[model samples]
Target chain A: LAKTTQPISMDSYEGQEVNITCSHNNIATNDYITWYQQFPSQGPRFIIQGYKTKVTNEVASLFIPADRKSSTLSLPRVSLSDTAVYYCLVGEDTGGFKTIFGAGTRLFVKA
Target chain B: DVKVTQSSRYLVKRTGEKVFLECVQDMDHENMFWYRQDPGLGLRLIYFSYDVKMKEKGDIPEGYSVSREKKERFSLILESASTNQTSMYLCASSLYLEGGETQYFGPGTRLLVL
Candidate 1:
């Protein structure tokens, strides 16, 4: 299992774009990068996932470098409600019990 | 829109008591997992089941056990709960896709042991 490291906290104003980066230096060849967002008192929700290059969805975007050792999660047009803890995970396609979630980046969107 | 439902949102239990946490998913996924989330620990997997009646231990499985009787239901059992077991218990289900698997989580159960 690859351990992930990210910022403890971040601050952003409403309508601004925020990018959170995660480092997984020991990522495996078959591992994929995934991002999840969790609000207070709620379970984490999937934001985006990617193997390499960039992947975009309606909620967020995931950018993975060629080495696959690092990834960035980009949230566009932030709002107060977007304040949450974002987690980056690296694991195999069927990593049921092996998926590791480290202390995620807490993003505070101010209005 | 995959939905995972937990048995309780909040629970209180006494030390040495037996605690059971139930999770159900309607998506019929083949894989279900049990994890505990702490303040700085983020989420630690307790156990996971890939199919019915099969389970695998995760990183921190010392005080926890799991059962998967059916494909849609997974249960976490703590025989003798302690104050240290108090935390947010999360249940998730995921289907193995071609490239990767995306886990869908329930609202989570906040367990407090005294």
Candidate 2:
């Protein structure tokens, strides 16, 4: 499993764009970058996933660099309800199955 | 939508008492997982099952056991509840996909042992 490092916490306001970056220096070739969001007292929800370059979905976008050493989760027009913890994971198959929940980045969307 | 339901939302038990945490998924995913969340420890995997009657220990499996008799249901058992075991227990299910595997989680069970 590739160890991931993310910001402990972040602050954002409504209508603002929030970007959270995760570092996985030991990322493997087969590993994929995936992100999840968790609100208070709720299960984490899947946001976006990508293997390389960029991938966008209805909720957010994932930007992976060419090196694939890091990835960024970009949320547009954030709202107070967007306050939650975001996790970035890098793994494949069974290896990915483990360590799905590391210390995630806590995003605080202020009013 | 994938729905993972836990047997209980909140549970209170006494020390030396047996405890069972049940998790059921509607999507019939092949993989089911049990994890415990603490203040700073994040989420630690207790056990997971890839197929019926098959189980694997996760990062923290001490004092914990699991049973998966059916595809959709997975159970986490504690032989004897202890105060140190008091924490938020979570259940998740996932299926392997092209891009990656995404886990669907349950609301969670907050267990308290005294």
DockQ, per model, reads 0.75, 0.67
Candidate 1 lDDT over B45-84, as tens digits, reads: 8999999999999889998899999899999999999999
lDDT by residue (tens digit), candidate 1, A1-111: 888999999999999999999999999898999899999899999888889999999988888989999999999999999999999999876545478889999999988
Give the per-residue lDDT of model 2 (tens digit) for B42-110.
788899888999898998999999999999999999999999999999999997888788889999999
- Model 1: residues >4 Å from true position, as ranges? A95-97
Go through the candidates in order and give each one's C-alpha lDDT: 0.92, 0.90
- Give lDDT: candidate 1, residue A74: 92
Q: Show model 2 residue runs off by greater than 4 Å.
A: A94-96
Q: State candidate 1's DockQ.
A: 0.75
**For every model in order, what is the number of clashing pairs?**
0, 0
Chain B TM per candidate, please? 0.98, 0.98
